[model samples]
Target: MQRIGSLPSDDSSPGWFHTSRLRQPRPPLIGDAQAPWVVIGGGFTGLAAARQLALNFPNDTVILVEAQQVGFGTSGRNAGFLIDVPHDIGAPDYIGDQANAKNILALNQRGQHILRDLVEQHNIVDAQLRHSGKYQAAIEDKGIAVLNAYRGGLEKLGEKVQLIEGDELKEHIGTSFYRKALFTPGTMLVQPSALVKGLADSLPENVKLYEDTPITAVDYGQKTTLHHPTGRIIADKLILANNAFGQYFGFLQGRMLPIFTYGSLTRPLTAAEQASIGGKDFWGVIPADPFGSTLRRTHDNRILVRNSFSFNPDGRHKPGYTDKVRQSHRLSFERRFPTLTNVEFEHTWGGGLAMTRNGQGFFGQLRENVYGALGCNGLGTVRGTATGTLLANMLAGKNESLTEFLLAAPKPNWNPPEPALSIGVNFTLRTGQARAGLEA
Candidate 1:
């Protein structure tokens, strides 16, 4: 249908999450022709859509193919924080269609519930998932205003959120930097990579999954075809769930600019150390300041921290780490909890997130019935899940609510290094960092 930027078949993840976390049997590709439905990208959105389709429509043969193993993308490599609402700090403007935005939000909440039910029903213990509330802390007056405005809007808009300020905040999260904070109790945290692996393993036989089979080129038409090295996939419909690193699909790349964010996990703390920072009961996030971070404690007893942003000129991993922008984004951690100075991270990693020029998640037809979803911005976990399903449903001729609110196609590839993304990213990040400091 639409075109995506070029992406390499090889992935860039260090052996961090894979070695220690994700555990799913990588399925091999049988051949080019699969069922009428084929989904690309094995991340949460892709897998979710794949499983949902097979469960809802048992007769449809669904094939899901991934360039690498499961949970290999940002979906699995992400810091383990799950906020129920489908929202991005920049979403108000990014999602210009208000009706669509509302539907996106509702769908995200439903997805969260869907995940929770699946984890419980299947007893997905490897995910080590836990239900812990998350906080949107206020760093300054403007930040507080933003949180309050969001809280007010959510409350008026019928979003299930509770606003806590002043002393009430102390009872929830012990961060003093926040003058006020908004709380969402329905969120759950998980070992993201593990969760993805678990989901993939739970797929029904009707949903064929393949790894190590990368598509060399995507030939789209009434019946979309994906070309692989030894095989090809010809399906009645195709769905591209690649957010960042989605460049490989001729339809995704420059259409959605990929931006990177860094995250580090702290070694588990002793009882004394745990008390020093607040207890290990929750996760926290600041408003969306491009560099803004979201953090949480995992069921494995480690602190999973995510913050800061990065860009690779090559659009792949940079060689030997050319530059280090901020000394330590953990400063936000230290400022909020001084005791973290003594804490150390067992591992640190980062991943790219995709976004379009307009900031909306890209969805809709590429051609006759084929569809693509991209641009999760910062909240792709939920947004991707929402878009992945919406796109799948559209191909199936089921849901049209999201389609109705979808926006005009953004000027393709206007944002980046797909043709020249690195330069754009470096310039935009520097400017954004400066602006954030001034605003701070």
Candidate 2:
């Protein structure tokens, strides 16, 4: 039996979750329950796994457990891009080997297709799912060079891209802060909280979802048992889709890094304030530098600025961390929109991101009757869904190409112990952010 050590306990409320319409969360697990399949974590991966399992095994019972409401976790705290291409945050050019990049693109596209279908089928209008594409914008010369390299890589992959600059770029994004940008029309933007909530609410009837139920311990075997505060679950098979917290379950130790990224959103801009920035109603911009700030104009006329990374092994941030990060976000936002001086951030929050030394994620059987799909690097929105769906398909004995591809993917490399790991990670993050300069 493994005693879970830590769980996600963010100190701030995500702007995405705060602005979303509130709904009654599914009741917490109570007493005891038994199911053919049990999934831990109610984020993107667990939700996808539970839904797919139900679809694959209609007669079997699938149970999904969450420590909090579905949209209140990391899944709803992202910049809300359903990226359809390779977005390796560790890579200098956001592209690795050509062959591997192609495979990743296909997998991400598959995930996007799955989500698009669900949004249409369920009529989840609040999700704000749109194929708005996205821009990789650069402010400095160094950042511009990075964007040029990224554009070259995309063109090599036979993907369509457009270069927008000067007045034209300002007209589109309402920001003269960027010197140039590479626009790719494959990525989809969304209200991540709404999307995850919709997916959870529309889950198949065979899949039972319980909220605010944190697994306290686990006994792994042919028939695994998971214990919570007031309830226990016995299942023939168990899936751990909890990302970095998977280490607490006695797996992926010393292999995964729990990193936190922060974001801040302003209250909806007034009509006059919106006109001050002459641009489209909504658009998203990713910095050319991986460590730089990510900006978005929401459908309801608000600006979101996301940046800063921290090494937090406990899967939680310290008190006042969000306030510190929000200061940095304010600088980033002000630099881009100097005219919106009076605009203030209404919400600021942070989310955990699971990373690995080699940028590889764990996928496949971890032990007897137990499997895991986690460490999504920084692209959890799409990668998490893809790996989760593929994992369920693999368990169902579906011999599809994507499933095989995922099973063959490399796992995270081991990291040095303790102080050394922390020291190295902190140094890298600080230096990277410093180099991002005005981009941040």
Candidate 3:
């Protein structure tokens, strides 16, 4: 089948995490290389997969290629919530079926443990890793109901969760705007770009990393040959870890929805502005309304706000998208913290996230001699790492229920083409935002 999508240009995101430190250049692939395994993409999933392969087979060569720098894509553009619960953004209620929810929770927990071990082992202090849990806050009565349902869902899975409201919610979040909130002690937070960069920098000796090397074409046969302008990678096996970009390779084409979410970060607050805010030094909050905003306060006193989604099937965003997003973000920030009106956002950017209509994603073989673990929905950090590590283990001949689930999870449902799909998704988003009301 002919490929129908173009490679995304380097993201124009001005992320705070990457800008905080100087970036060391990683050399791109040159000439040609032969390896037993080749993994595409340099995000969390790809990095984790490459790491697993190197760890499992020290004698075998593993090659990893990226179209851009390691964390420059969706991997680095996220708000960095390592959620350990089911967060099905497509569901009528954010939580899905009970059995699947429990299973997904288990998967998330497993992935969290793996990442935590890596963070500790590598001493990834620059990532600003935090074991701090997340707050699911609701502003309106509808939002409160949603939070209640979410808490009930967690209870059904025998998970511990604390539901707070009124003064309790205000005291915890330092905001009277939230009427109710659910605190789950499992979510972890980090500087997304830093974590991915640290992981790439600490890869095993058996793994070769090729940055800024976009594969222009792929010739799949008994062995897959990935062709880049500077070099080619010929490997006995191929693993797709590019998430939504995998659709371009005819891996779950027309199944996953390629949507872009927008985020904006404020410059670090001065001590006066920080005191005006009156909250803790750091906290992360995921909105109770799926369409509402996600907010985070950084350790350095900067605030990050994520809200807004647009359907971009080809992974290309319009030129004026960020301008519009910045206005929305400014409004969101002003509404939440009137005290810090002078604190303006320093950066605004968009990142692609693949959404499945049925809340399921592809995580198995897509073609002969080719394997994939794409579509993290919105929970890419934990789920992507889990799927990538599990993909490596699956290829290394490991089998368990989690392995089976990873290999056999349902693929994304088909979406209509072009303008029709775009219209439908935007309509759904608008309706959700309307329902979200003040929460948005």
Candidate 4:
């Protein structure tokens, strides 16, 4: 029996979740329940896994359990860029080896298409899923060098990219802070909370979703039994899609690192404020430096600033952490839109990213009938979806090619325990942030 060390909980002010049109969450699991297939976590990966399992095995009941309400966890707290290309934030240039990069692009593009179709089919207008593309902007010469290197990688992949700079770049993003930018039309922007909620609500009939039910313990055997507060669940097979939390289940322990990143969203800009910025109504910018800030102008006239990373080994933030990060966000926001000094952030929150020492994600059978799709590094939105879907397909004996590809993907490297690990990670993060300079 593996005891879950901790449950997922977020700060009170998740910008995306609070702003989204959220329905009442489903009731928690109560009493005893049994299912042929069970998936833990309500985030993108678990939702995708459960949905696919239902589609693949329509006759079998699939149960999905969430520790919190849908759209209120890490999945909903991202910067909302569904990148379709190789976006390895851990890599120096945000791209890997050419062949590996190509494979990643193919998988991520497939994930994007799957999500796009779901958004359209469900008419999830609130999700604001748009092919608006994204800008990779650089604020310093070093940052620009990184962007140029990234551009070269994209060119090698035969991907289309446009370089925007000076007045033209300002015309599009309303930010003179960036010296130059590379725009790629393939990335999709979304209201992440709405998209995840929509996916949950549109899950297949055979899949049962239970929100606000945190599993307390798990006994893994031929039949897996999960214990929650008020009830227990037994399943013939299990898929762990909980990402960083997978460590608590004794699955990815000593391998996955739970890194938390923060985001702040300003209250909607008034007409005057919008005109003052003088750019496209909705545009998203990813920093050229991996540790730099991410800025987005929402369709509804709000701005989002996301930056700062902390190595939270226990999978939770310390007291007052979000407040401190909000200050950093304010600086980033003011640096970009100096005219919007009066526009205050309405919400600030932190979200966890499951990273690995070797910059790889886990996807395969863990032990016996237990399988997992964990560690999305920093590109969880697309990578999580792709791996989760592939995990389901693999279980159902479908999409063998993609399944084999995922199986062949490298596993996360092991890490030293506790104090030593935390010290090293913190030093690395601080150094990266310091190097980011004005980009942060």
Q: Candidate 3: deviation at residue 230, Å?
A: 1.8
lDDT of 1 by residue, 242-285 (tens): 65555555555456666666666677777777676564355555
Question: Which rank order by lDDT, best down to worst?
Answer: 2, 4, 3, 1
lDDT of 2 at 393: 90
**Pairs in steric clash, model 2:** none
CA lDDT of each prediction against the hidden true structure = 0.64, 0.91, 0.83, 0.90
Q: Candidate 1: which stretches are off by over 4 Å?
A: 1-5, 8-24, 30-33, 86-101, 165-171, 221-223, 244-247, 288-290, 313-315, 322-327, 406-424, 437-440
TM-scores of the models, in the given order?
A: 0.84, 0.98, 0.96, 0.98
lDDT of 3 by residue, 1-440 (tens): 24335786634765754565566748998899999999998988999999999998899999999888887888888998998988665455556677777779888988888888888999988788898899999888888878887777777778889987777666666566777789998899988888888888899999999888988888888998888877777989999998888887877878888888889999898988876657667789999888899999887778999998887777766678899989888988888888878888888999888888876778878888899888878888888898899889888898668888765666688888878877899999879877788887
* Clashing residue pair totals per candidate (backbone < 3 A): 22, 0, 0, 0
Name the better of 2 and 3 by lDDT: 2
TM-score for candidate 4, residues paired by index: 0.98
Q: How well does model 2 score by local distance difference test?
A: 0.91
